[model samples]
Target: MKQFREEWDLDSIYVVDSALYSSDNFQQLRQLRWITLVTASLKVVNILVESLGEETFEDIEVPGYRIASCCSDYGGVRQRWLVVESESGRAQ
Candidate 1:
């Protein structure tokens, strides 16, 4: 991400697989000020569903990331989605 920013002078967004989902990776992305759309794991989805009950989606705020959106599967396989943007991008 740093290379991308330095070389191209551009902000970036990454669509990553579930394998890359981790607290450390998230922190790194936040530090880089990059946005990411990550595939939520089943455990994560289950927890959200249990906490949210009937709600399928919500916008949330975190310390360094703006959780622009979150949604759960209402049909088909159980799945969850999250669109996380760096706090620096919030104004834009």
Candidate 2:
């Protein structure tokens, strides 16, 4: 990300899978002012479920993020997508 900003003079938005979702990675990205759109892991979904307890996604609020979209497979598994942006990006 630093290279992209300094060398290429580009602002990059990352779309990463659950495998890359970690507290350390999130902190690094936040520190660097990079935005990421990621697939929410089952662990994250579970935490939301536990916290909300029967409430819908619309009621959830993540300090630096907005729920961009969600999809579910009622027949089988469920998946969620979350878009995380910086406070600066939220203004634009």
Candidate 3:
């Protein structure tokens, strides 16, 4: 986790998101409905792979991408999106 914090900056390590309460288009959003959640790369993709048995996936779907950008200024793990290398057979 220390490695991630240093590499992703304090914002990515500590994220927050704002939600406007009571908008005409998003009436579902309300001050009373506000909540907070926690998300970390190690807690997400890493954990998912772990649940699937990392030993079995070593030859399968390895992490072919890296965290190109993470905007903790947005919300949750919105910053930890997958990135495809230019030479890789995938979309950017």
Which numbered prediction scores highest in lDDT against the true structure?
Answer: 1
**Stretches of candidate 2 exceeding 4 Å from the true structure:** 1-8, 31-44, 53-92
lDDT of 2 by residue, 1-92 (tens): 45544665435555555455556555434534333333435565545434542223342366654333445332243444443334566465
Residue 45 Cα positional deviation in candidate 3, in Å, after optimal superposition: 1.3
Whose lDDT is higher: candidate 1's or candidate 2's? 1
Badly placed stretches (over 4 Å) of model 1 are 1-9, 32-42, 55-92
Ranking by lDDT: 1, 2, 3
All candidates' TM-scores?
0.38, 0.36, 0.16
lDDT of 3 by residue, 1-92 (tens): 33533454332233324222112313322212233332333344445433443233222144563223222323221223332223264342
Candidate models: Cα lDDT each: 0.48, 0.45, 0.31
Best by TM-score: 1
Q: Which stretches of candidate 3 lie over 4 Å from their true place?
A: 1-42, 58-92
What RMSD does each model have against the real structure? 12.7, 12.7, 15.1
Q: Write the per-residue lDDT of candidate 1 for residues 2-92, one digit (tens) a residue.
A: 5744665545555555565556455444434333334445465557634642243344555665442455443332333554555475455
